[model samples]
Target: MEIAENTALVVVDVQKGFEEAGFWGPRNNPGADDNIASLIDEWQSTGRPVVFVRHDSSKPQSPLRPGYVGNDFKDYVEQRRGKGAGRELLITKTVNSAFLGTPDLAAWLGAQGIAQVVLAGIQTNMCVETTARMGGNLGFDVLVAYDATYTFDLEGPFGWRRTADELARASAVSLHGGGFARVLTTREIVDAAG
Candidate 1:
């Protein structure tokens, strides 16, 4: 659980659009923002690299679409802008994985000699999970801050519904058990960082 000094914190898709519970349905982890803010503070204070991934939804009516205020980073993340020394990066992605984002996440991380990545953001079962899996597959040591990510309830095409908490737990199990990433809580990561 030792966090390397050069480890990168890749925050994925924590945008204002996600605040619209009406659009995303009920969500789990109301304190995800606080957890993410704490992690960012720790990373900035430690001078570790921080990568911010933004999701610019291509869907016309989506709240996260370009030109909308909802597409902007949340106030907490926005306020931390330029605080990561020169180790800060902003990636714009339309997909689920930050690795597939603009400016090339993997290549940039490689250039910085960062092999470890910690993930935290909105949608625990979607963008965050995808980025963690892809990061691990690409040979990076990946850690997922489970309590720093949130997800909404989802319904299957066949009429079954899964709660947000259920989905989050499932994602944790999948990532950890499948060997894609080490899923840990925000407290655990912060303690390790110390």
Candidate 2:
């Protein structure tokens, strides 16, 4: 449960579109903000790098399309901008995976000699899982903040409507059990950062 100083917190796609009242927003994960906000503050206090990934949908019908009010980050993230607080690295990606078709995040981490990544953000089974797997494959120890990420329910092949909580469950099982990453709670992360 110890978070090393060389660890970087990678917050993936915590945009306003995910927090707003809509189909894409998280309805099952009720306290996602509380978890993510606490981790942000903890990482800031520890002087660790906090990397933010934003999904910019180029499609006209995409939720993060240009000029959309819900395309920006939420209030918790907006209030901390330009304050010169933490080692904040903001990058925007257009794909479901942050590592694919984007700037060199791995190179940036390599330049800083960061060997571990703590991931937290939206779409647990999508972007967060993808980034965590990539980070692990790239030789970085990956830590996934379980409660800090959110995703909407999805329809599967069967007659089952999968919920966000269910998606989160599958993500933890796949990422952690599959050896892609270690899943932890926000409180454990804060305690480790201390």
Candidate 3:
């Protein structure tokens, strides 16, 4: 899993709402921050690329609605303020598809000549999955850092509770089996990045 110099790590919404004390708050994303930091460090050192995708929930009831406290990137990510400025890129969107709703992520990737994307973030079955599918459709080889993504339980159409772990694994299965992405553990990602 060698990371090319043109590779980019697409970090999706890891907002405060998904951390230890917000909407989907739970300490479930094992080694998420660490893995992200490791990858960030490697990418920064190598001058590759790191793109941060933030979800700006535009609806009033959504966790990231404007003026809401949970709208901001969580402490772990936000805490790295003032540093890594030019080395990283930040993009915001109001929908699940980071590529469709935001400034052309695909175009930007093409501009950078990026052929590979390593993904990590929260709400594994939602934004993360959506972006991976879009990235694959756009022809980027995608790798999802499994432990670096998390989600919450919800009552689906089946009337059963979908746990965080369940959704996470579901994303892995769907993305990996659907020819969209490869699901790799944090350790695998870190090693690859290194």
Better of 1 and 2 by TM-score: 1
Clashes of 1: 0
Model 1 agreement with the true structure over 66-137: per-residue lDDT tens digits: 999999999999999797754999999999999998989999999999999999998999999999999989
**What global local distance difference test value does model 1 have?**
0.94
Question: What are the runs in model 3 whose C-alpha is more than 4 Å off?
Answer: 20-22, 25-27, 85-87
Maximum-TM-score candidate: 1
Candidate 3 residue pairs in backbone clash: none
Question: What clash count does candidate 3 reach?
Answer: 0
Clashes of each: 0, 0, 0
How does each model score on lDDT? 0.94, 0.81, 0.78
The better-scoring model by lDDT among 1 and 2 is 1
Model 1 TM-score is 0.98
Error of 1 at 172 (Å): 0.3
Candidate with the greatest lDDT versus the true structure: 1
Give the per-residue lDDT digits (tens) of candidate 3, residues 1-194.
77787788888987765644454544356667787766666666666778888888877877776687777887767755335533467788888977975678888888877899889887788998999999999899999888877777767787887677777888899999999998998788777767
**Which scores higher on lDDT, 2 or 3?**
2
